[model samples]
Target: MKKCISFLTVCLLMAKLTTAQIIPSFEFGVKGGMNLSRFSHTATFATENRAGYLGGIYARAGGLGFNFQPELYITSKSVTVNSGSTQNKATFTSIDLPLLLGTKIGAFGVGGRFYTGPLVSFAINKDQNVGDALGNALHLNYKDQNLAWTFGAGLDLKKVSIDFRYEYGLTKQPYNNGNDETRINLFNLTLGYRLFSL
Candidate 1:
């Protein structure tokens, strides 16, 4: 309940900022790319790295060396687990909201920007089939909501942009046992094109 309230407060603050805004330029775009993800598990669980996908749309509003970016995107995380002779894989999906405040620096031809912000994510779906080789499947329950931080840099040239980012999960995911937990962490590279500029 506290987390939900905090999120609401952040939203209200952003709304207030928007009402007083005077941005010189606004650009809307689509981005998609591959992500390499892994789980940082406690001593009770062993896990490996796996690959996933991420894609989303974003709007950037600002100019004159600064920008405010807000995005709504879908992200995926995967991990590999080994238990005895059985190697299992699990993937989870979530919706991510990122609010970024940063500055851009470049010349007449291209622009480069670095941004850092908080990410609020909600897990929507997951696919896990652990312990299947042992004749039964194990169930894992994780929290639906999570908080994270992202920092990255990107370059914009013409209508194309590319960026690299790292996200560290602040909230840990817990299994049914409660004592066992894992935090999702990953690095992502994305390529985007401006579909429209407003």
Candidate 2:
């Protein structure tokens, strides 16, 4: 494990060197937006989208047409279960980090931006027992970590950016019956601003 970490560190150092030497459009930014999150079921499960919050900070490097962007965010989202006439929701607060590779979509890096990558999330919310609107006890098993695939597009307007992305879960839900799988997916639209440049 230590050897792997050392190797990755060396690779990152090489990338930083290459970026610093070849490209100079480094920027640090902040973003905040809303998310429409829901569960995508494989079987017959009725659920609706839930509104959530997303806010974060990010750093950009390598910008002579292509760049690498990594962001850390505090995100809140939920999934609603349709049980008869009453709706039950499970909300999770997570720390999400996405490492993306992006490139300019237009002329000489002046057009639009496209990015896609893996998102790592750790649920900061703990296990709790709650009652539904009709007073049924709900027991939950909490899982701390999840892996997701994220892809998106953005328009860069100098110091600001407008982005849209989708995140799909690669694992099972934290709380579920063993009979089927419940995966969550979210649509995110964000507006961001570059606070500084390097």
Best-fitting candidate, scored by TM-score: 2
User: Cα lDDT of all candidates, in order?
Assistant: 0.74, 0.75
Candidate 1 Cα errors over 4 Å, as ranges: 1-23, 83-86, 126-144, 175-179
TM-score of candidate 2 to 2 decimals: 0.74
- Per-residue lDDT over 1-198 for candidate 1, one digit per residue giving the tens place of the 0 to 100 score: 999999998888666444423447788999988788777765646778788988889888886557898876777788886656777677777767777888776543377889999877766643422222112111222244678899989998978989888889888876433555678888889898898887
Tens-digit lDDT track for model 2 on 1-198?
Answer: 999999998888767645543666788989999999888864456888999998979898875667899887788888787756766677877777788988765432234778899877766643422222102111222244577899999987768789999998886675443455577899999999999987
Clash number for each model? 0, 0
TM-scores for every predicted model: 0.73, 0.74
Best-matching candidate per lDDT: 2
Per-candidate Cα RMSD to the true structure, in Å, reads 14.3, 12.9
Show the colliding residue pairs in model 2: none
